[model samples]
Target: MTGRSGGFGDHSLKTLEESRKTYLQSLRVSTADATFFSHQNALRKFFSWYSPTANKPDSPGNTLAEFAKHLLTTLGQSVDTVAGHIHSLLNFLAFHHQSSPDELRVRLFSEIQLLSCPESAKESLSKEFGFQAGSEITRSVDALRAYLRQRQYGTRTHAYVELILAARARPTQIRLLNRSDLHLDEQTASIPLSETYLIAATGLHNEQTVDLPPDLTNVLETYIEHERKTPSQSGCQPLFTTIHGRASVGTLRRSVKLASEKARDYHCATRETNPDDRSPVDSVTAVVPSDIYRVALSDVENTS
Candidate 1:
């Protein structure tokens, strides 16, 4: 491999900064400014994954394939996203070997040319997150509400549930909520536009403000004034908190799911008690945080 004309000369130079710089410089002339930056970013990420500290791959094609698979399975990237990165990788590899002899190009292309995005990965993702119909979402909301009312649920939990049911807020947005975001006097909550970048990362819908219903506002007022603890000295004052201070998005999600589970159990117990009564048994739906958002969306569609 050494001393070959128009090929990467030294092993050290090939894997280090110089090789990457040469490829990026060649890319700059052929690509648009936006595309050049995109390629640069992709290359940076690829090199990071193929770390200088780690053992270098004998076959770059195999490394690329493994990287693509890692994106889908571990990083949870969409197929289109993984495809885009793969395209960037191909360009980087092709430009590096453009000046090399024909056989090198053939060897490289032979391994990578057949690398197509896997459709099965997308199907697996869909199966992992179960599909919830519109009717199921409504039933889930009803069951959760009935459970909260029947049991001695904490004011904080009850407030968040009521706010989502009324405001149609996403779990991320609700989790990011601060005490200052709530305006009990105005009967509204503000989702600051400044946090849009953070919110967008999680695929949660964000808006300027959400009008809270009177009943919902009252529940929040009670939670804030009584149940909520004093803000920590750490500076970030989250609207929702546990004994430890700010509650994580996972905690918020779990709270909603636990309530849904209890509601289903309660409904089942009630039906068993009155089996001979012959009245219609109320529907109790198992739900997650996303189902609540779907229910909220359904209500908006019905009204509009």
Candidate 2:
């Protein structure tokens, strides 16, 4: 009995032995580039013996199922791992056979059964791949700032960071904001900024005033007057321009990080001179507009 034409035709002892060797080779080659190749290889070898073709007819599908069982029971692979292997093997079969049912479909149900994730395995998978429990927005801000520092971004980059922070923007919002989203009142050097809100609000609620600290305001005013003097591009866009006039999200993120790092280094040096003080000097905290509003409203109530 020989394995030929992409299927096992006979169930003789010699044919079964050949099938086992082929399976072992297949498993070994499948994992050649993977870190867990050796473990997978060993599991396949055990399955070849436990479910020899001579003892049970070798259908492409059944062979896959037997290997899957070996992963679960013999090798003690977690359900997620077993399921992953099964998915890979199923995809391999589907691709090779050019369809789902090609002779291999005979054992598809059993393969699926072997791929079932236990409750414990499900929990483990969730823990490994679940959403992080903190504020993703804050994390994004920190990440962008770190990246900017690593790249040593410049002033335009700082404006971009301010844009995102002031807007309390999500990545998509940052990506979508354009010059149209901002209006420059040169008379007041005030930029009226609009951003998408996570929750719906009353009229014009999504817009926020970006109150730049006096130092930053002065720096920006200088940039706009000295640097952005060139005629506006055909589009009256505010957020991004290829030239020195506006800022892109990538540029902004990088700039924030560079500034943050410089600030940190500066703070560190100052702290070194005053060794008695352990508190971080430039520990900039994100101040969302809502928080500021709440604080201001509380102060007004207290004063009244």
Candidate 3:
């Protein structure tokens, strides 16, 4: 359903091309470089679909609305991705027709509403952390961090764990990061939008800056200075690496899993035991990178 534009008349095609160019030029001054490119790509896709070359008998009497449905249903894009496309299309329409996007959306797409279905905080914690309670999850994370800091500090394992906990990033995002992305002095790291899962999940188009906690910054500094190896290749400076080269996503996940298990075992073994009382450490759950992200979202919702 995407990139099929067989029905548009030549005049319509020319108008779309001109309007797209003018709209992008207008956006250039106000938007960031990554945002400009994202808008450009989204509009190109929208124009491809907007071509009168294709016909739909059940178009809901609105082209934009029909395209939105196609993006969600036929293309199977996440709601966030679909919203980006709709946003770009609305802005383009507003530019060409001299109307506000809000007015255009209401007049043309009043019946369409974009919504997302995600795991509830409790469900997410149970699924990802194997814990039903947020408090237990927090305790597990604290134990894991404490174990890493005391025993594995300055190693790749410690850096990876601290990075995920601080950044609340998926392993996929971490895999795409590079050493150049880190700004240790500023306590931030940039995640590029291209091929990033964060873009699909969060509706962020431009490069994303993840704020680093001071502890993570210090840990990263130690790892880089003493433990990290130079990339085997000249131009590839992956932020996380192994003895060979850049660390794979599998490596990061395995490291996280192992670290969590070790923490659980360490805490369970050393905990003061009473014959009468059930050990609280018995319920401690293993952590994963995604659990951190879910917990972070839950925190934000609670605070808001």
Best by TM-score: 3
Please write out the lDDT profile of model 1 over residues 1-304, one tens digit for every residue: 1111122334353554665786577557754788778878778777767653465444544556556667877777876776667666654553343211112222333334344446585354223322334665676577688778668344677877877666655566677789988888987777542232322222221244667778787778778878887755578788899867788778878888888888888877867887674534556667887787656544542332
- Model 3: runs farther than 4 Å from truth? 1-135, 193-204, 273-279, 301-304
lDDT for predicted candidate 2 compared with the true structure: 0.42
Whichever of 2 and 3 has more lDDT, that candidate is 3
Clashing pairs in 1: none
Return the TM-score for candidate 3, rounded to 2 decimals.
0.53
- Which residue pairs in candidate 2 collide? 145-257, 148-254, 148-258, 149-257, 149-258, 179-237, 179-238
User: Which pairs of residues collide in candidate 3?
Assistant: 6-53, 7-52, 7-53, 7-54, 8-52, 8-53
Model 2, 12-104: lDDT tens per residue?
Answer: 555545644544455454434462454345445544554443454355555666665567677788767765665555433333332222123
RMSD of 2: 21.2
TM-score, per-candidate, Cα-based: 0.50, 0.32, 0.53
Number of clashing pairs, model 3?
6
- Model 2 CA lDDT for position 82: 64
Using lDDT as the measure, name the better of candidate 1 and candidate 3: 3
Descending-TM-score candidate ranking = 3, 1, 2
Best by lDDT: 3
